[model samples]
Target: MTISTNSLMSLREYFSNQQILICFNGPISTNLIGEIGSALKEHIESNHAPELEVMDVFSVYIEMSQNIRNYATSHGFSDSESSATVVIAAAEAGHYAVCAGNLVEMGDGQALLERIHELAACDKAQLKLLYKQQLRQPHTQTPGQGAGLGLIEIARRSSQPMEASLDPLEPGRAFFSLRAII
Candidate 1:
């Protein structure tokens, strides 16, 4: 496959319509995450975003990307399965949205989606309590297991409720996507 010029143009048009400022799709490494994260910070600063909002967006992006990287590494996924698609877009009312997606085992995706839904239902105070609770728990023994604080933090920082979806892919895998508006 060769992508024709028309197809490329169409993709660009779609991104523009969505107000996407940055997008990356592939296997993410620590170095790549850092590089992209720096770019994101610069973009936010240049746009004159508030300092607190800029920090929130940067932190959320790092947390989400690291989660994807760790999940893929711990699960022994192939490169294609480990690859992630991350996007930062401008939302209405001067808000920004960070979205991420990757293929995951169907079961794992469902569990994560459920957790996200639970977090989404919570009010800000509830999320704060949850975050504090998670922070107090000892880290899981497993190398890649999380205490779920990252999800709670994301929810607390978001201006709107977080959203997540799973799209069935192969028999045992699905594409899990999450969007957080800040």
Candidate 2:
């Protein structure tokens, strides 16, 4: 098998057209998350993004990446199942879009997508209330189960409603993707 140069160039051109600043697709470890987070921070800063915006982007990226890592680990997924795709891109009017996806059990992905849709339908004040309510809830001891406050926090920080989808793969599994614009 031979790799086509034109195909590689087209891939690069696609990213450039989409204004994707950073993209990673593979198994993600804790250390890799930190490294990518650092690069993301530097990239945003160098672009003269406001301090708050930078923090929000970094925070959301960490939360999303960590959730994928923890979920994969808790479910005892193999490396292939554990692989994740993350992208940070420039959006309209100086906003940045942080998107991530990973493989998940079909049921789990559907449940998560439902929750995200609920959050997306909420107004800012409603989200703030939900955030506080989630904060007051007791934390779960399960590895992949937290108070679920991260989702609320991400919603609160987003300039627009968060978006999510679950694409069916083979039986019992799907690809779960989320997008948060800030």
Mark the regions of model 1 whose C-alpha exceeds 4 Å error after superposition: none
lDDT of each: 0.92, 0.93
Give residue 105's error in model 1 in angstroms.
Answer: 1.2
| Residue pairs with clashing backbones, model 2 | none
Tens-digit lDDT string for candidate 1 (1-182): 89999999999999999999999999999999999999999999998989999999999999999999998999998888789999999998999999999888898899999999899899999999998888898888685675298889999999999999999998998999999999
**Cα lDDT, model 1, residue 3:** 93
Best by lDDT: 2
Cα error, residue 142 of model 2, in Å, equals: 0.8
Query: What's each prediction's TM-score?
Result: 0.96, 0.96
Q: Model 1, residue 137: displacement in angstroms?
A: 0.9
lDDT of 1 at 170: 81
Per-residue lDDT, model 1, residue 60, is 92
